[model samples]
Target: MDTLKRDVLSQRVQQVRPSGIRKFFDIINTMPNVISLGVGEPDFVTPEHIRQAGIESIQQGRTRYTSNSGILELREEIAALFQRLYGLTYDPLSQVLVTVGVSEGVDLAMRTIIDPGDEVIAPDPGYVAYEADIIFAGGVPVPVPTYAKYDFAVRAAEIEAAITPRTKMILLGNPNNPTGAVIPREELAAIAKLAIEHDLIVVSDEVYSQLVYGTEHVSIAAMPQMQERTIILDGFSKAYAMTGWRVGYVLAPEHILSAMLKVHQYAIMCAGTAAQEAALQALRHGDADVKRMHDDYARRGRMFVDGLNRIGLACSEPRGAFYAFPYVGNTGMSDEEFAEKLLFEEEVALVPGSSFGNAGKNYVRATYCTAYDKLEEALIRIERFVKKHA
Candidate 1:
């Protein structure tokens, strides 16, 4: 049978663990009538106009194949979006490459730059995809832990301490997954300086850029010296609820952009023609929609975090992104046990803290991306669950 394994997978593939988040979800999915708060994706449908645009593209037979870097108009729209929102300038022609999704963007960037034994530093309770992609890229991942006391902000010294001759890059998923903590401007400046002094590439995964509650997001590329070395990974998934569409882009220096484009050109030639067009529509006609979604997320974040706190499971107020990571110590269970019990007993499924990393061991990452009523109900269920266990 072809199932017989061939050659060993470059050593790196074997080193990676399955996504802890998805692993739990697969188990939870089989449970009867379970409501999942584990995944971080928004519950909102892609805006009507964006969906209309995609449908219109299909109707017009605009699906043949766009350029490898995406349609120029879409790339231009993404570049303009950078300027409009982050005050950072990117050239649509040479600096921006639309990717399959931020997932692919992460893969492309890492695969493009990493050589065997190279090191990439990232947040401990970080984006799971980032760590996985680093391993697949043949880079060793060095995780710097972010703590609850500082709202999980990436400390500059922690980053500085992780450096070595093999350290080639630092991945920052600010408004970070699992913890929703955003890097302030001063901290961003320090990070930029550290990257410059260390001569390291900065891969800023700002996919959650638009989901911020009230704080402003400062793009690392917005810094003068850092712009040339910073690669920004962002997309319509988190911003415009276009996760299923698989549309994301990377902004890098012309050299790295060219390299990543070659990778994208060969592996996954172009992003979805319809998805790209729809994302363009989101950028052009969806400012109001974006604002509305952010407002809704902010309200839900407040509701969910406050609810968790009241139940004696305190969570930081999420400054960005749609997740609330609350410590589950009160449940008198290990993170996995807490999550499993919560699912069976309370009918709510959340990613266990340890799924993200050791630093996240005692916590649970719950998303407010679910609808308000669902979140409210989940909170009520969680309260009862906590009382029962307590």
Candidate 2:
């Protein structure tokens, strides 16, 4: 029976490790009064107007499946949003594809462009999905390590060194998870130049674009000669606090979009109709709500990062996103050990940075998306825990 079960599973599915973030979340569920700073989800509710739009769609009996590419109206809104924010033009009918979420967009982009043994270069300590998704699609994930000294920004020269004859794509998560490091415009331009020279595809995940502080979010696709070779994955989940709604879209050149749509049609059919409606509403009227949330996140980031540094964690100030990646090696423990001990001793939960990649082995990632008072308390407990270890 064991042999039969083993034979039933594909090697790829069996070999891909489960998400490291969820391991801590599962432990949190078994404990009480635990202040979790691990998950990267927004604490705010989806804007009221967005919710109302979803509700109205349901009330109006608009729950049938949309076109496999999604509703035209939502696609238009997505296109308009890109134009309005970054001055990037995408044809709503041919270049935009609605997906279940940015997760699906990632999957589709990988499978659409990668063949067996093709190589994709991505940052080390990146969003956890980047490596696994590449493996699942039968491609090789080449990780170029990014260091805290450089603010965790992957250098263009390092990326150039990693390129090989088999290299097919470059995957990027701007306003990166785990580190919250935003690559600056000049570095992005250099990367764009490399892609143009190498004839490689660039998959730019801009989900956190709107959450930046004190820096403009520049899309590589907006660079000269990039639109033809870049695939942009974005969604309302992060910006509008619509994580549960699971609506996102892809913008690529028509050829790439068509190929991705084929996979999306077969695998997902379409994103939820009401959710798409809600996302449309978010695009049309959620600017104020986004600004309100962005301001709150910026404030929270400042307070939390200051607290972490004050407590001797040596966290770099995150310029974007809501995470603080702090070096925990001074505690004389591995990141895993520090997180485990902190949880048990202080009832505070955060993810070990090694979960992201090997380069993050001595760090831990804490998110400040919790309420202000909760974050303050978590900081106090973390300080106590650090002192105890000291």
Candidate 3:
């Protein structure tokens, strides 16, 4: 019997597609000398000071599980940092739940609010996990497509149009993945207003909140009367280059937070003690490291976007995050074809836009999270490939 087939897996699990981002990388892993611009992760190591804190925690034998909600000290710092950055406030004891990563927070948020038939509206061409998370939680994921013409910002009208009586929440990633578009304050306010009108909860995934270049990141949670309705998911991974640390947190109303915590306590017990200590240090003293990395990313963003245009791939200037989503339709190849051909021909690996959503079909997402010299080399190869194809 093929036990893995048909009835073995949950229907919801089988209904969701595997992550399109990892599907290609699985192949790339078997190839040699490939320069991957496919993954959205900071190539930098965790800052020395932060690493030291984690090491110190182990040395001091503080290796036990923290409170199910997380260490109060870390939660307090997170609350303070949110207030400082977005002018949002939360009671550390009741409103914050430390998570394994923003990924876990995403799952927990969906599961907490989304009953079997509930709907959650999110941007199409968003992070791949958004849809899968909603589906796994037994909720319907309604995607509203954002376009390159509009710089990929999710419009309030599009979101409202997708809403039904079934929609219980709105999910957003500010400083969006794949596209690197940041929501403007005015537009965010409009969306918050719509959420309020519809009585829908908002889950604002601000993992890349600190990575913007010229523009400021506006938290929808900070809008008038929106704090109680918006759930903020953020962490040290992106800005601090601490991906392996696996530490993130969610901030929401006490009731919502408590329900999420109930799931988290059973599913995770607590985030790693060492990581929590390290994250506390990051919140307290990692400003210099964050600034240094952001400056470097800004330099690479300008160079990469300009290089893509020069190579005949029309790309909008990414205002935030470390990716450049360029229109690759001129190459006369599908998004996946362009990516596969680029990998085989030039040893350069990029994520196909369709991996994010069908709305991204004519584009490709290239991450600038690597070093400058590596980015330059990748661009040269891309230019050569473009000439051959275009």
Candidate 4:
């Protein structure tokens, strides 16, 4: 009898690890009475107005496939958003692409720009998917460490040190996922200068742009000469509490956008029609809802981060997004061991920082996306767990 080989998958697919975030949630779901500070998603539902818009679109039978680039109105709204927010202009017709989500936008961007053997310089302790997407695009991902000493902010000097002749692009998430560190404008300008000197494109994932606390979010694309080489990736997931909506957009130079659209057209055809309609309403009338959610996240984030630090985890106050990356080395356990033991003993779930990259080994990412009471309760359990382990 001939046995079939199980190793027939593409070598690239085999090389990458599965998403570290999802694997933790799978365990959290099977357990009862668990307090999760795990997943980075809003606790709020999509605003009523946005939901109604989606429902109305469906009722109106606006379910047909849109132009491969997405409907004109949504693209126009996106362009207007860039103009109003960053003072950067993009043509709605040729320079914007609507993707299924920032996830898809990232994939499209990688496929569009990366050539075989190209090197993409990304920040470590960053998003888990950045390296995987680069590898899948047949590019080498060079990780530059972002240390807690520097508030986990990616620095231009670190990026410049990591660059090589093969380096082709910079992939970064502002208001970063695990650490929730937003890069300052001065540092961002330094990075832009590096990109220009090296002639590299910048893939800026600003998905959490609207969730900053105390400071306004700045887009690197808005910097002088940057619009010509930066691809701005953003979406409604974080701002509008539309994680399930799967709608996001890319603002890029026309040449880059056209190349990405060719890939998007074949890969996804178009984002969901109803989701697009909902996104339109989100852009037009969802401002108040976004502000409301942002304010709540700020409150929860302060309370939760304060609680963690007081409990001996030494969490830094994150400036943006809703995560608290706390140093758990005091627990006398590795990141994975601390997370695992806490989950089993205290019924509390947190993601191990090592899941992000080597640079995250000493920390753990705790999201404040849950309700205030739940966060407080999780902090209590975490405190007990740390005391017991210590």
Candidate 5:
């Protein structure tokens, strides 16, 4: 009887699938000589100056827990960075709360604002985490599927149609993950208009803002009307190549932030002291290195997307972010089939579109985060694989 006892996991836990992107890598790990285009982290190291800042903080005995809301100096620095880069002002003391990473900020923002059974308008073929977290918090994920023809723009009419009386918030990713689709300003303005008319909160995830290709990043907070209702999630991870630093923040309305702080206090007392200090240093003095990294991603984007199209895959040229999301339908194979067959036959790893959402079922996501030579090799193998299948 004791041996037959049931598990203790919650219903919400059971409903979520383990990361779809991770499932491929788990198998890829056992395959030797595999040239992975599936890698998510940047190929570059955290720039030396940012790394040194973390070291200096520890050497100076700045290892103690920061105030539950984080240090004032760091908050001030983040506020200035926001203004300098995207022209948004977040009251450093009252409206900003440092979380473990952009992910945590996403969690707290949703947790604080959403009621159970609320509708969360998130992009389809979007980040797995968005849907997973929304479900974990008991809000229904309403996927807003964008398309290749429109450069995957988020149409306001589609957004307006998706909203229900129970729709509490819209989870927006500027320069989206997986798809690398950036929402244009006009589309954003339309969404903002809907948000205003319909009274919806906006959770704008701008983690990839600095990684834009030929355009500047526009924050939802930049629209003064949207600012009051927008919860901006950003961090030093991608911009500073500080993925492991676990330092990120949220800018929200004062009342909403006060509520989010309660969750942060109980769940994560504060972000790492050293990482916070390092982040502050990066924001204040690390623009040149940051710009250099962004420039490389832009160059790599062009190279990878061109390579994909030349090889017969219809890739929407990513305007931002390091990912090149291309449709794999030319091989007449499902996204998962294409990913798996390529891995087993050619030893190249890429994520299937279906892993993100149904809208991505016919696509695959390739990261330009690898070396140029490695990307070249993956494309070569992919060309062979496509020819064989065709």
Candidate 6:
């Protein structure tokens, strides 16, 4: 028989790189007593009331598929959340679509707005999935470099420089990942101006909006005349400590939302029934839980960033989210080399900054979402490693 040639995966799938975060996670799985500061998940459990809602739903046989958009009550609560937090309004029936998670919302938004060859301008060193999501949807992701000197805030001028005639969207992760740099209100207004001038959509990922310390999270959509041009992706995963529950939502203009809904209906049908029920409870009664977790994260962030600086890693205090992206260049090693050597020698696991994007080259991301005691120990180990190397 002649030799057979089998090419099974699509070109897009072949082109996409596996998650850099997952690489360290895989290695940690094989090691004993590794202290992981890589994943961006909360150490807190889902609040008791939220868990009970899901349990009660299942107990009552409410486990069937929900409305294609999601359970109506959940959608209503989501709408109300935006109104309460940012004074943005949307009709739940026409403008809200619950998704599997913010991850799915990103995929759906890209698919809904991007035609082939369209361009999206996003911050470099952003969440790892942004580029891949655009690529999977056949759009080009144009990265605008953000620097640690400015605390990694994506400037409006930089974004305007990257925009072209083909640019269709501006993607933002406020209270950004890796760096945890929250864009200031004036900066967000400036970016909103550019979006309006370019007539481009803005996909604002505000998953960490409620977790900021010493600053308010300004939603770009809430800027004057910008809501119509913005798509908001947020959910219970971060604030409510409901990561495993896997429920999120999108708020967009009705027409754009309709298109996203069509794609979602085919791809997912609807979010999990019980999860939606749980999310409803989260929206309704999880304020106290969010505040408690946010306080914990705020304290941990201050202590961890202080530790990083004391250990000569040169990290700024993160204003939001749970990550501390510290410059490891002082240790005379590339980010990858630093991460690898630290993990092997000290059993402390963190993702290399280069994994996020080229802009993160000499940095490494260490999350403070683990227990405070564990973070303290990780800092001790890291300080020991840095002294030896630096």
- Candidate 4: tens digits of C-alpha lDDT, residues 133-214: 9999999999999988778999999999999999999998998989999999999999999999999999999999999999
TM per model?
0.97, 0.98, 0.98, 0.98, 0.97, 0.98
Each prediction's total of clashing residue pairs, residues at least 3 apart in sequence or on different chains, is: 0, 0, 0, 0, 0, 0
What C-alpha lDDT do the candidate models reach, one value each?
0.89, 0.93, 0.92, 0.92, 0.87, 0.93
Error of 2 at 388 (Å): 0.3
- lDDT (10s digit) by residue, model 2, range 293-365: 9999999989999999999999886878889999999989999999999998999999999999999899999
TM-score of 1: 0.97
Error of 1 at 325 (Å): 0.5
Preferred candidate (lDDT higher): 2 or 3: 2
RMSD value for candidate 3: 1.3
Candidate 3 residue 354 C-alpha distance from true site, Å: 0.7
Model 4: weakest 10-residue lDDT segment is 2-11
Q: State candidate 4's TM-score.
A: 0.98
lDDT of 2 at 340: 92
Clashes of 4: 0
Please give, for residues 1-390, the per-residue lDDT of candidate 6 as tens digits.
876598878888887899999999999999989999989889999999999999999999998988999999999998888899899999999999999999999999999999999999999899999999999999999999998889998899899899999999999999899899999998999999999988999999999999999988999999999999999999889989999999989999999999999999999999999999999998888888899999999888889999899888899768899999999887889999999999999999999998988999999999999899999999999999988886
- lDDT of each residue in 1-390, candidate 5, tens digit only: 357478889998998888878889998899988987785678889888888989999999989999999988999988888878778778899988888999998889878988889999988888889988898889999998889998776789888889999998999888888888888888888889899899999999998888888766788778759988999998888878889999999988899999999999999999999999888888878999888988888877788899899999999968777898898987888999999999999999999988888888889989898788888888899999998988
- Candidate 2, poorest ten consecutive residues by summed lDDT: 1-10
Count residue pairs with overlapping backbones in model 2: 0
State the lDDT of candidate 1 residue by residue for 1-390, as single tens digits: 567568756677777887888887788778777778999888999999999999999999998889889999988888888788778788899999988889999999899999989999998898888888988888899999998888888889899999999999999997799899999999999999999998999999999988877788888888869888999999989879999999999999999999999999999989989999999899889989989999898888888898899999978767899888899876779888898888877789998888888899989999889889999999899999988888
Candidates 1 and 5 compared: the better one by TM-score is: 5
